[model samples]
Target chain A: MKEPLLPALKMTLLTLVLFSGVYTLAVWGIAQLAPNGGEGEIITHNGKTYYENVGQQFTEDRYFWSRPSAVDYNAAGSGGSNKAASNPDYVATVQARIDSFLVHNPGVSKAEIPVDIVTASGSGLDPHISPKAAQLQVQRIARVRNLPLEKVQALVAEHTEKPLLGFLGPERVHVLKLNIALDNLK
Target chain B: MNTEILGVIAIYILIVLLALPLGKYIAKVFAGERTWLDPVFNPLERLFFKLSGIDPTLEMNWKHHLAALLGINLLWFLLAMFVLMNQGWLPWNPDGNPSMSPHLAFNTAVSFLVNCNLQHYSGETGMSYLGQVFCLMFLQFVTAGTGMAAAAAVFNAMRERSATHFGNFYNYFLKSCTRILLPVAFVAAIVLAFSGTPMTFEGKDSMITMQGDTVQVSRGPVAAFVAIKQAGTNGGGFYGVNSAHPLENPDYLTNAVENILILIIPIAMVFALGFYLNRRKLAWMIFGVMTLGFLLLSLPSIYSEMQPSPIANQLGIDGSAGNMEGKETRLGAAASAFWGISTTATSNGSVNSMHDSHTPLSGAMQLIDMMINSLYGGVGVGFLNFYIFIILAVFISGLMVGRTPEFLGKKVEAREMKIALIIALLHPFIILVGTALSAFIFYHNPEIGWLNNPGNHGFSEMLYEYTSAAANNGSGFEGLGDNTPWWNISTGFVLLLGRYLPIIGPVAIAGILANKKYIPESAGTLKTDTGTFGLMVFAVIFLVAALAFFPALALGPLAEYFNH
Candidate 1:
């Protein structure tokens, strides 16, 4: 043990420099070629810059809502509500989300609410909702913005992203981008 | 039936297929055979040994290997503590995250050093970029190398020959990092970066939402951090929510990559043993049992998660979308459940969804997988833990057959059995005892505010913390609010013991077995690498590890499951 200690100290330093210093910088160099320089996909619209990947709060009646966030879409940090699936209080919170949705979109029934829209996402930063999740909320967006229902539905369809290779991921819509498109409509 | 399930199935198939060759490669790397990577890594490794003033050719017994492992680990721990404690003052702390509290630092340092990586603090606010790279990510690589090196030494001992010296620890350690972990992580990191995962040194970026609110989006060298974190079977998150964070795991492709990365080496090491021992059948048999165990745990969790949870019905909410309380819409419920089991089984505890929010049955399966670990397990130690179970099975079956037990023609004596038994029992002892104390405190002082949810689920939270600690499986019930001194110090001890004891006990047993006279195989000797023997090993794991946790599990997840 004593004989190995001197070497251990040196090897620790050597590997530390190799992994944390050189390897990290090497990866950083590779990331330089990535879109948006790997600082997250930032898009500017109407003179405002927003990260396309990170979820944002979208509670206004005139826009499609993102999933409920435990941290209120606090991107400086991220987390889930972590409410137990069977906890009554957690169930009540989901109930409240549903009731609120029904109030804002009076034409929708309880069964029509997609669970993704009511339950909190794991990251508290889920930018996308299921395409169905986006579809169900279209009527409200149409009513609030005074647009025809077909026009709002078409906007949702236009913004919907296909699964990777059409089978590798889920079909979903980025709420921020879709809402932006709705705002830009003439 | 959906495309999401296909994505999960694809990663499962991809990793096993990839692990087959990786295992052979790993065996070659440790056995000192020539490989394609040698031209690149040989000179680099030589330079490392020369600068460290270490002779990589000195073969020592298991004691020396253990000493070498512990000695370097101690130094690494101190270095990690220094970095974490001073991370605020360290360079590249762009978020202005403060140095960790003394208790948090101790817990964080010990947790990562042991390869458990039970994070008590959120990464965005709790850690500096220096801390992310130096303190945590560095440990992810080295600790995995340490586990692989220890297993490699054990492999040398298991070779059907009498010997005192096994192999050089530093050589295997260096080879594992250079020839295995580093190259794979480099490629995976690039994949992650290209798929929208962030890899930058900059601080948080202020973004204006379309709704007129400014939000701070945290950014760092996360792709690189996440790559090693998963590939090393070190599940520490670069951000507070782990892979759930969009920047850490940006999409389904990156999620699949991360999942595939975590399982590859662990499953591959089983095959490495087969190659190392020149027994492909044994590797297949072991892989078979592990896969059966994995399916038994995972399929149920997936089914449970996909069902509309009773809570949804009770609250009159729509049940068609399954339980989505803490799952991402892009990944969906089935994929998250699959990940929950995969992460716990591998001891790579990064989550794409919150385990605390999983339905009762799925949550139970996660705990059960950790408690009865060694189902394709974590890094090298996963096999080590399973090796202990193998010895116990050999001894128990020997008793049934009324013949002295021998593994690979080496006699399994009383000494070996005692060591295996103790190692087998230590995991449960730490987890159960620690939970009892924490639960006692929680019940006595309900206002401590440790639990975010009440009743059975809260108890499940306490149980999950200790189980995660003792199993060296570091996913948590995130709502536990467990950064207080009691949770931190107690789990710190569990993490240390849970890690070293399993490594020490098995290697010591293997070392003893290696010193014994090699007995020739006979009809009287019980065959270890057979299907019947695999069943016996599974039974032993069930009887020993799984049964001990039944009562505690019942009180938590089982009770929750049966209610309503």
Candidate 2:
């Protein structure tokens, strides 16, 4: 055991220097080449800076609602509610979301509510919502904003992001981007 | 294949190339050979042994080794619990994160202690920075070291001509940390930090979005945490989204580095075993079998995830893009699917994408990888798990040939067989029983509401959770509300039982075999190093997993796959 000890410690120290110092510097150097220098992609609109990667909170009926956030859309700390489906609190939370959606949009039915809308994403910072989630909220946004239904529908279609390579993920709408487009509507 | 798919393939190839040299270096480190680092580490190692009162010359039998492993683990569990339950007031908590609930604390402590890292609670809000570093990060080093130490002990026993004692547990443990895990983790941590993972202790930073709304951003010592998280195969992420967070995995290069980090040590350990025993052929045979299983599991995942979602087609949406519902655009579908398979196969549960959001068949593939569990598994323990199948194959084949069953010149008798069977049977038993109980509770009590999606997809989530816990793989479906007392407690027990028992059983069997009378090779002797034997071991693994888990899988992922 003593025979192996010295070599082991030497290796540890050397690797620490290499990994903690050199490797990190190398990786950081590469990251500088990445978008936003790895700080996160940022978008400036209307004199405000927004992290394009992080989810934004939108609750007004005039704007398309983002998915439910466990941390209330806190970009600083990301996470899900982690409430098991069996927990009464989670059940009530989902029910409350459903009820509120129905009340806000009289034309929408309880059965038609998409699961993604009522439940929080794993990352509280999920910037995108499923296409169904965005579509379901369109009627409410059109009514509240006094926009024509077909015009708003077309906007929803325009905002929808297709899965990568046409077959990777489900269709989704970047809520922040879509809402920004909405505010810009003539 | 497209460039994305080809890139993923190239990455797998690179892991093999990197692991080969690492394996040789590890073999030398364990054998006490003179190396370039000997001058630096020798004095430090001597100091550790001297201060701790561990005799470098001492050796211990299997029972003593097992005792040392469990005792240290229990101590870690207690320490982790104390830190977690008191984290709110503890130092380094700039976020003022509250202390964990009792059940969650218990689950978390046991999860890390066993290297299971089955995180029921999110990292950012659920734990303070002190708790993250002291409890979780500390366990990452030791637990990984513990598994490697145990495997090294088994190697010692197998290599000896005739000896009841293998080596000192403390010595092996220390060596594993200093010589292997610490070095790799150091480099990995730096890489992660450089790639934009936060390495600070600052509290939440407030930022105004383009919408003119103020939002709080959570940051902590994520870079350091993620390094060991991947390298140690601990899999618990600093953030709730694990590797999916931009800070946790900032870009494509970070993704590639992390995926390679997750697999390098586990694959290297196999080569280390070969080098230690001077059985390079046997090592290659084992590596071949594992790589085959890995490829079999990974390809379908990529294909399934690459296909357009059938539901999207029904909605009149283009199905040209692959499944990306739960994936980051930086990683794309191919990389995400590759990670889905790699993470589960290695018992490294860090995810760049949500497994729950994958296409039904892709979800099933992830579950299958965990259920099989030994395809290049977590560090040292993976080979140990596969060793059980190897023994079973040898024994069955020996019986068929009307000869005595022997491996490495040691006869496989009733006691050895019993332990092997117990270890092999225990995995499926825990997974199936836990899933059955959860499903029963979900069905009998309508108010429980454990299933989020309802019907087939919901059942798949429950199955995935239990399978992850039972295999000590720790990745979750995320949609399942699992932070409650029931899940925390149930999975906690499964994590402990799953991690220790398999380790103890295999090491004990190795000790027993080492003590048996050695038999010289003859014409009738079954050569385990051959490709034929590797196939046999592979078949036995699939057969056993199929027998025990097929029905349950059919009910969950399989059922969901067909329904979709």
For each candidate in turn, the interface RMSD (Å) is: 1.2, 7.2
Give the distance in Å from residue A16's predicted Cα in candidate 2 to where it truly belongs. 16
Per-model B-chain TM-score: 0.99, 0.98
Give per-residue CA lDDT, model 2, range B1-564, as digits (tens). Answer: 465676687779889999999999888877877777777678977876665556766889999888777776666777789999999998878888899999999999999888888898877788887788767877787788889999889888888387899888877887787788767877776677666676655677778865457887777667767888899888999888898886788666778889999999999999999999999999999999999999998999999877764433433334445554556545667888999999999888989877887777788789888888899999888888998998899899899888899998899999989999999999998988888898888888968867666677778888899889988888998878898898999999988888998899999999999888877778878899999989999889998875688888888778767765
Cα displacement (angstroms), candidate 1, residue A131, comes to 2.1
Counting only residues 3 or more apart in sequence or on different chains, how many pairs clash (N, Cα, C under 3 Å) in candidate 1? 0
Candidate 2, A14-131: lDDT as tens digits: 4334334443455445555545554545667787777676778888888888878766777766765544333345556667877788898888766566556666655666677667
TM-score between candidate 1 and the true structure: 0.99
What is residue B45's positional error in candidate 2, in angstroms?
2.0
lDDT of 1 by residue, A89-148 (tens): 887788888889899888788876777888899999998888877888888888888899
Encode model 1's per-residue lDDT on B435-476: one tens digit a residue.
999899988999999998888999999999999998888999
